[model samples]
Target: MSEKMEVDTPTTAATEEKKAEHVTPSASGESAAEHPDMKLAQAIHKAVLMSSNKIPMDTAHIDTLKADLIKMSNPSLIESLASPLQWDLSTVDIAGMKTANETTLNELEEKVKEAQENAGDMEVLEARIAVAQFAAKSMSKKEALAMYQLVLDLPKLSSGKQMDALMEQSRVCSFYSDTLKNKDYIAKISKLAEESGDWDRRNRLKVYTALQNILTRDMKTAASLLIDCIATFSCTELCSYPNFILYTMMTNILYLPRTDLKAKIIDGSEILSVKDDVMPVFTLVKCLYDCDYKGYLQAMVEVESVLLADRFLFPHAGYIMRELHVLGYKQFLDSYKSVTLTSMAQSFGVSVDFLDVQLSRFIAAGRLTAKIDKFGGVVETNRPDLKNAQYRDMIQQGDLLLNRIQKLARVVDV
Candidate 1:
């Protein structure tokens, strides 16, 4: 899907205005700086900036981050939101921000009181939501979280309103990189979305759940969720459409079976739509599916650059790269009962010694069903017998079931 596609219309006026102000893509398209979640955008820029101190980044990229940081740093917002990151805020107007925050809160308090007195419950709720949103956007993190809770606590809130409040809370958690709290909020949102049967919100919840899973390093679950939502993604508040596809390809590449990878990702229309925009990732997946080991290796380097530069993917870059190598080797080895180590290394454009050491590590870890013979200079594939494997699994599970049943009988006798 195109990033600019009108996936879902806002249901309420407040939601419409919110999208107009924050989520709408600019004419130049949605860049990181143009992300709807301001706090997440700030956090990403700050993360990249800090990573620069340890990793050598090009001057242009560093310059862009610095500029984006300055643009996103709001003095009136939470002061300590970026504290954990230890990002320099010298250029930000800390004192003026504090003053502005106090003034805004006092004004909002008066509005809430007026609404409560003269207007109906709905008006009061709307006023309170405004206060909470303001807090989320411009006040301290503690105050923002508290305000959102207040909105959620208000009685007679519709399912839609509850979902909105929960989503806002999730965004706040994400801004602070609170993965645990973010996951909790996502769970709440998921329940509400299902209860309401709001298809738009349900689609959005898939993206939210996928992102939370990614943060928790549950790549298999994340990949499943992302792949399922490829055609229905409408969560521009979290990320652009192209980026969503990029994430889908990245996570699925690590765990998806070859057939599913070929069907869903290799030939999926949604993925093909943004292939040019995310060419590196697409290239990596294509090379692996096509069994072009040399091409896959070359493409992996480019893909690694993209992964290392991403705030979400940076921590997992090394692991993902290593897994990709194992995946390539396992797929290649699957085609043959035994391939000479020299030939395998040559196909991957790597040295035989490097391939030998790499395969040995994975083999010992039980990640690959293969053995390497240093003396014979050959690698033997040990493909498991499917029926035998399933039978053994059933036996193990049956034993556990019997043990549980015996324990239950003893308790009954007691």
Candidate 2:
């Protein structure tokens, strides 16, 4: 117990705040009687001593005990923490998958309850505890939400726990295509993260917020937030080279380019290098940036697996597909006044019939700015006069100037 003691500091305090969330709840909701002073030590020993043969190693709460156990020279305890994240004991026996998982889940639930009881009411463990329980049970969306909400509602959940709960909720809602619910949960999490003074979490929360905003009609806001996230995060030393960061950087530029961020993306390349797995995503962005329609389509096919596996990224990936297709069509229509559908298909790497349908969608959406002649198999581009384009640019610049001046006036008054 003496060796288990750590000096209490603000950082350690923050981490320990939700330490209770790792435990599964008891059926009776009553914790075993334990002395307050020895609770954390007891919980650590119990968790170590438990039969973890069937327990998945990805338990979030287990991370807290990692350093201490290592200091105590506990190799078996460390090894027990290294199983596949989604692996479950129940999945082993086909006949008893649910029953096995449920039994293990029940045991975890009892352990968590006792741990929390020993640790005291102020234990901030909802986030870790909720995640552990949810993973163990592998419950349906309805059941997960109900159980998770109960855990979330517990008193004294630390900011980290709250964010975890929100993130877990976000994942659940994402699976069900519950866009509105995802938006609400992320929005709440964003605010909580800000208040918690966890700068890293707050920055990452921007990604989630941007994702949900994209699901809604607020694309402009989403783009802005993504740009900010990419710029802020990429420039940092904290896990900056993740595939998602690069994707965000590229996606923002796909629809709206930010001058400041584009430079950061290039510089951060040296510090936070891209992984090989994310190469296709990078290529896709390059294609879009370079106006290489052929490459863009190829890169899209290449990154299909990455797009499907990433949850936060999964939803926005469609935008990339749709926008890139639109951009390709926009580019394809650029050099020709009229081109046969067959020629267009060959250039863009698709069937003539598919191009015809895709072109029609582009046309109907008012994106193509051209007409598809079905009989002739010709897709024509409608180019505006240079004089008209120049005039429109003049008006747009004037509007921007006027808005800036108005904003400046308000600042002056303040």
| Cα lDDT over the full model 1 | 0.75
Which stretches of candidate 1 lie above 4 Å from their native place?
1-51, 58-73, 76-91, 398-414
Tens-place lDDT digits, model 2, residues 182-247: 878887887765445344556666666666665564666766776676545521211223644644
Report how far residue 212 has shifted in candidate 2, in Å. 3.8
Alpha-carbon lDDT, every model: 0.75, 0.56
